[model samples]
Target: MGQPVLLSLLVLLAVAQGVVLAYWAIRDRRFRSAHRAARHLHSADTHAGRLALVGEIAGSIAHEISQPLSAILTNADAAENLLGEPDPPLDEIRRMLADIRRDDLRANDIVRHLHSLLKRRELQTTMLDLNEVAATALSLIQPVARKRLVTVRSCLDPMLPPVRGDAIHLEQVLLNLMMNAMDAMASNTANGAAERILDVTTDRYDKYSAAITVTDTGPGIAAAYRPRIFDSFFSTKQEGMGLGLAIARTIVHAHGGKIWQEGTSAGGAAFKFTIPLQAA
Candidate 1:
């Protein structure tokens, strides 16, 4: 009887020590996370300030470049017409000129995207087609998906109603979400998984709201972390700075919408956000 009682006390003490250690570890982690979030916010603020100056400078230079770019395109067209001559096989020259024009347009598109990112304009609320925004994001990420051997599909409602928001900002939100999906699946692909897919869907929830959902076939978010997924500096990716989802949540909320995780049936992660539908 005496030996059994002593053993029971030892077991209870061990359990108590484990509980104390776990509590300490959790408190330490929370403290570290708070510090990381503070640093991230500071960095993001600094980055935004620099982008504002860049936006102004870029806006100025864009005007100057357009004139020269226009002239160059005109000259290239004339050169192509001249190369149409049936002598010396200027076909190579024509093809080279075509390539140059193609690349020039690609560069212009990149400039537009950069301008959108840097512009600090106030939210310009207007009628927006969320489906169209999702389509554009899919187009942008298609290449990345292909490179990762991931299949991306969409199931957009054909008669979805328009929502009110800044089109550029909305596009940014969808793009951020889609890119996050791709990043999440990157590990699965690296491991030579058989299948990787991302699906995006949009619909009108009612007369008042429109919704979009982005789902990925990657390792799902742990239940413990889902609540803090949108919190600043809360990241699952090793290299992620964890600002993407935070910025996304800000954009959705600014548009008078709610964003949340709806853990998927596909055993992966899904995120959805909704905005107020604009009346026709």
Candidate 2:
């Protein structure tokens, strides 16, 4: 009887030891997995940051170069006009020279804007007119829209309150969204002859947020793909690398704002983003 009791006690001790070992193994595995996941996330975020930096640099270079190129074109046009006439008109030549100067200044302003965007600096938060940002973005994208024969419309609330944000980044976000909308419509070129339209609007929300929406008259996103539309590498276009919306969302979120998509009343797609208004 004593031997049997000792044997039973030993068996119980062995089982308890096994349980403790199993628990430790499971806990260690979970820790390692979590650690690896965190590292991967950090690496992905770093990669995105690097890509954004490169984009800003390239954009600035283009903007700076474009200014000089624009001035050259204007001068060429002016010279052509002077040569076309039987006798060159002094007043017309003077007007053309004035236009060249004006365009050069315009180009200078573009370079300044690009420089501000590419500068590695902290966010200079200030009260910003959302309408001005919207207009800036629209102006930048207007040429692209015209090339595609797309009609661009704007409905801005003139009395809207100001929101706090980095103007450059916010403008970039809006530009990306508008470009994506254009691309979405471009993909359906084979379906039929369709007129493309992009409607942009700014409104004051009752929830104390300022909203900007970009709506496209394109084939709406499928139901199954809606939830994952913002995911990295998820794209509907055959040639798309799918970083636009993801980057836009990141920028918006960094500004303490939100971005989302919905089906528009125009029977197309609409993407709306919001920034909180500065407190009075």
**What TM-score does each of the candidates earn?**
0.64, 0.68
Clashes of 1: 0
The alpha-carbon deviation from the true structure for residue 11 of candidate 1, after best TM-score superposition, in angstroms, is 79
* Top of the candidates by TM-score: 2
lDDT: worst 10-residue window of model 1 = 49-58
Clashing pairs in 2: none
lDDT of 2 by residue, 232-258 (tens): 878888877777677678767867889
Candidate 1, clashing residue pairs?
A: none
Compared with the true structure, model 2 gives a TM-score of: 0.68
Model 2 spans > 4 angstroms off? 1-94, 119-122, 188-193
